[model samples]
Target: MTLASDDKVLILFRHAKAEQVYGKADHERSLTARGRRDAMAAGAWLHEHELGPELVLCSTAVRTRQTWEAAVDGGACGETVEFDDSIYSGGAQTVLQTVREAAGEAQVVMVVGHNPTMAALASGLSEGDGSSAAHECLAAGFPTSSIAVLRYAGPWSGLDIGTAALERCHVSRG
Candidate 1:
């Protein structure tokens, strides 16, 4: 598909599953073995799809950080990721604002954060004009390590509810 110069790709990635441990703060939880493998698979998938992100906005939580690290180990070719505390608990609106702040010059941008917010943002921004199967998969659920690939045909600052199309969606499992 031919994309206009203003077109941009937004990849909303939910962090892989984290171990459920007692006495640990939610932000301190770490990824489980399965979570690590799944994260790696997600990285490989991103690499294979050529969704080369110029910037990654990730949550400051430990599991989220580990998820990015594992994805890199699996060949996600990104050098730097901006860890934002807002993404950890900031509502979807705050996360959107953060992403808009990154509207500099990148064609592809990825955000790795917790669920509910990720799922909500993905669904809210989608114009429902892309892959039907992907849409179905996303509607089913935004599981751990799942990615919602959205195409925004405008500047990041121009993004808003129902302004982007859900290009593709996948659940990465290793």
Candidate 2:
């Protein structure tokens, strides 16, 4: 769980906007057309920034899965992806546990799920100085299909409060 140094990057992403249907199960809700475009844009941003995740842990919900697929299709990341049911209803603690369990060999890891866990995790982990714009955006809110990039210098198990520096945040504009 202890990495050699603070050379790891964790990317937190909230799933794109999903359809709202009365009486429909939340797990089965799918993304809308704009959501698809937003997801793709997020992926492209990751690719362009060279921050693509080596491993992607995505929620099992339809919208989250579709978001990951769109990101992958857009050349954001090409690697192993695990669909985790826990993330569907998990909180910040659950997300912390999931990241702690990630493979040590993975230099970059991404989690795709819902909010406010994503927002909470990002705000909770961030410490020290970072991009002003990124911090400002995060302070405002974590919108759907948004990405928060954090840099930490330690093992995954050692991830804790104020352990990381917020690198940047990107919100999909559709």
Best by TM-score: 1
After superposition, which runs of candidate 2 have C-alpha atoms over 4 Å from their true positions? 1-6
Candidate 1 structure quality by residue, lDDT tens digits, 14-98: 9998999989999999999999999999999999988778899999999999999999998886645899999998988999999
Please identify model 1 stretches exceeding 4 Å from their true place. 1-3
Scored by Cα lDDT, where does model 2 land? 0.86
Global fold similarity of model 2 (TM-score): 0.93
Q: Estimate each model's TM-score.
A: 0.95, 0.93
CA shift of 20, model 1, Å: 0.5
The most accurate candidate by lDDT is 1
lDDT of 2 by residue, 1-174 (tens): 233555888899999989999999999999999999999988888888887677889999999999998887776874888888878978999988987886467878999999999989888888545778888988888999999998887778898878888889999855
Model 1 scores a C-alpha lDDT of 0.90
Among all windows of 10 consecutive residues in model 1, the one with the lowest summed lDDT is 1-10
